[model samples]
Target chain A: MERNNDVWVFIEQHNGKASDVSFELLSKGRKLAETLSGSLKSVVIGHNIESLAKETFRFGAVEAYTIDDQSLANYRTMPYSRIVNQLVDAHKPGIFLFGATIVGRDLAPRAASHSKSGLTADCTDLQISDVKYLRVDYKNLLLQIRPAFGGNIIATIISPDVQTQMATVREGVMRLEPLEKPGIGKITKIPYLPEAFDSIVEIIEQHRQENKVNLKSAPIIVAGGYGVGTKENFRFVEELAHAIGGEVAGSRAAVDAGFVTPDRQVGQTGVTVRPKLYIAVGISGAIQHRAGMQESNKIIAINSDADAPIFGVAHYGVVGDASQILPLFINVFKQKLK
Target chain B: MAINSIVMVKQVPDTANISGQVMKEDGTVNRALLPAIFNHEDRVALELALQVQDTYSGKVTVITMGPPRASDVLRECLYMGADEAYLISDRKFAGADTLATSYVLSEAIRKIGRYDIIFSGRQAIDGDTAQVGPQTAEKLHIPQVTYTEEVLHIQDGKIRIKRKIEGGYEIVESGMPVLVTVLKDAVSPRPYKARRVMTYKNAKTLMELEKLVEGNSLLYIDQLKDEYLSKNLYIRTFTMDDLMLEAERCGVAGSPTKVHKVESVVLGGGQREMFHATKAGIGELIDKLMVDHIFG
Candidate 1:
């Protein structure tokens, strides 16, 4: 398997709209393409997705390889994977990337396995590097960096033995680049025969989850952790958030303790939030937790442990019990409003 | 109709006690120094398997690849209601990454005979690759549903599953002989029954029995293993030879991805101002926060 000489991104779309992650990958893939002195391409597979293929070019793709058909209107495991694997086999790329969404997670593995390639999932970062290890010179290896061992440590991985290095980066991990210009690249429609629509998954029903918590764009968040102690004590966190007109979130520990619902968890396994102001109550900032909220505009940590890791990322730190300090903070806000 | 189901489990070092010494310079963990326990997600996966058994008539078989001491998690699985457990242990299987481990597990799964469904945790806490379950399903050439939050139903030879995506979940239906990698919050595992624990406490794998025989010259390994098997206390064990796996594909040799480097990350904000528990300190903090427009 020789080098394919290009970086490719899978432009994920549903109902004729492209996912934000696909655009982010295109932006990141553009950087890899520059480093490798190669072209950047986008792989689009869906019915009536020509608009998305054109949109990829605006995001920096030099080409879009698309497979359009009525069977691709709704995502099914068998057909989507077969088509992606077919493209990879036909036009081998130096690098391939997918969003770590449900669809991508379901499709990428089967495609990679079909090609006998290695794939790193849920990656946080990607880079190109040249290094020497074990007497092997890894020239321009894709640095697939991810949090491992339950988010206590970060590990960098590379597929030295295989071609077409693949990775599925989690959504929102990388910032999306603005469009350089629109429709600068070409769209090459790959042929898809009707027989390729064979699948075992029956589409019983598909709809968006209504009333989903919009944690990504929350203006402010009041989050609690293990130090909050009990389910009843979490109300202190909610009261402060309510008084400040913000949403409530919790650390993995708090969520595991049943103090809050899984939807309200603020960590790597949960949501990645960058609220305007993030108030972390009694949260000892594990890297997993920090990875989710470290990008907030202003951070204030309230914890009794003076050396807690959360303080390391806080714009302001309060060295006292949250239960005692939250009441005081709420009262002060009440007075200020009056 | 009854179906045969297998659950893949792992024993991981308790990373909550992770320290500088726990991680070797080569990026591999020093498992001897740290306390080992059942991987949390794998435990939840077993619970899901048991629940499937309770709903549909079936027997749950739990298998794991680790050192001989890993039999602890196996017996615990029995105490929690696994029908049978296997210890897939060998020195050659040490330091196995996801690829090697999945290879060995898939081979043993083939030897274990028929199974309608296979369950595993989405990712082990130690490696965090989330690769083995999917990789195994691929090797076995079966469909897999990962990040599974719940098993909706199983009827007419098809199973419905609700799986977690980025922001929400989607319900999917898969035909028979599918694999599912479960999430930690999928289900709360039932507590070990006191009676089952008392009955299975002396359960031992063949390796454990060999060790016991080594210390006592009067006892023979075969005799003891047979005795335990008759008493329903012997755990099925498999080595590399038992699974007929190539030596090259059993451990580190089969792993393609290498850890380039390991760095201990310590968070730093450059400065942290500490406030006393007094009212004056609280008032000053409020003023600073308000000035920064963090609070209005």
Candidate 2:
């Protein structure tokens, strides 16, 4: 077995709590590590983040490497990336994963560039496999699969020549499955060396908005599209969502058409969603939209056009005007739940 | 110091607004059906650069790396009030991953020196990698603030920027020469000035001039390039040798990652159960969903 076989997931934390995407990566990393017959490890670098490292065990990480310092409280690109670069240089990890968040996007590319490593952004799937290219065999390569070209094509990418393969997966793409019994992983504390240059870009202020919608955690979503037609017409989607006790969402077209806000947009450009039930109303089911919601457990698409693409992934298809059908949907749901 | 800004832009396929003819029935994209335009976010970045030019005493120079046809975007940049444009094009530079592309860009930026700030879109729509800007910053050993929504102020060689975070936003301050990747909604880009458009419409890259001089014994490529440069109608075009880039480190060879496979995503049809538009059918579907605990 090669020494550089361990898979490392970077644990991201917010307000001292670990991000769910980090846990999701840990779960996904377990399968890749098992495929490679190697241990799963996680790295956490933040102030008072030892608890996050401890939390990694529940997600199947075997080792948790940590670097803690007061200066590392906020995610400054320079310091965070340098610390990651230090870890990469010292450990020579075979595969490193980061959540494709604001911090992750800022850090991963810099670290990957500095290490002269390959990094794929916004990967939806990852697997470990043997590969051959130019008549040369490479063992246990990380296959990073992502929807590129505006989600029209799914490309499987590999960094077979690089030492450490890196990928940044967005939140909710992978399933979060915690172990039945949490096994305590060995926690290794790494020293954080302070440098003056790391403070070149200083964060002057940060403001959080409370009303940020999290469609990722939504169990049921009723999404409208351009066919919902107008702001007046989009209430059909909202009424149905309220009746079903589900969140409201829309296609990129609907958002552009002012039927819904951009935060609730579901597509390649927007956030991916995997709900228990995804009811798409008046949506044509563009591939970009499908890239985000096709993974839902059950999808119901309603469109006036019977041939709408959204029906391709839906379990139930209704050919009808959203205005006509959504009232009926809301009425049935209200009666059932009442 | 007045900020001299270099904004990285690209001519990208209009992937977001793709139509039926653009996507063939076989699930592969029909190249001829795609129309290349200045990437939306990159144009916003250029608008920010032009705003920097407006407020401060500096010129905004735009750069892109693509085919000779990519010179089309450079012309658009000129029309939109860019003081200068550069096209880093070479046949060998094809199939470059983000890292390799950034390496060549960093080298080009070094050649076109004397810039206090660099700007680029957070991510291009085609690849959607968002890696090149930060990667170029790393290669150039510069600080970077990405996902920038607004540039609040620039004074005393320090720039303040408001950038989008996960839940909300944060403001950060950085010194000169920091790379800022602009978000799409950062600013509304201004339309092309009719006067500038008419003036710069004749602007051609060295490759384009070479094509113009093709099969013409009367006109020489060097002479045409010289005339165009003197008249400010030439977009500075560079080959690998022009920037002293190593052959192996400029393109596919330098890329650590490779495309192992490309599967055209074909969402299969014919599995779904169809229902009539009637209220009865709607109730029946809802009943099924509740019974399956999908919406219970």
State which candidate has the highest lDDT: 2
What tens digits encode model 1's per-residue C-alpha lDDT throughout B242-270?
88899987776776567776555567746
What TM-score describes the B chain of model 1?
A: 0.88
Model 2 DockQ, alpha carbons vs. true complex: 0.72
Give the Å shift of residue B233 in candidate 2: 0.9
Score residue A46 of candidate 1 by CA lDDT. Answer: 88
Sort candidate 2 into its docking category. Answer: medium
Sum up the clashes in candidate 2.
0
Interface RMSD of 2: 2.0
Q: What is the TM-score of each candidate against the true structure?
A: 0.91, 0.96
| Global fold similarity of model 2 (TM-score) | 0.96
* TM-score of B-chain for each predicted structure, in order: 0.88, 0.95
Fnat for candidate 2 (0 to 1)? 0.86
CAPRI grade, predicted model 1 = medium
Residue-by-residue lDDT tens digits, candidate 2, B91-132 = 889989998999999999999998989999999978888999
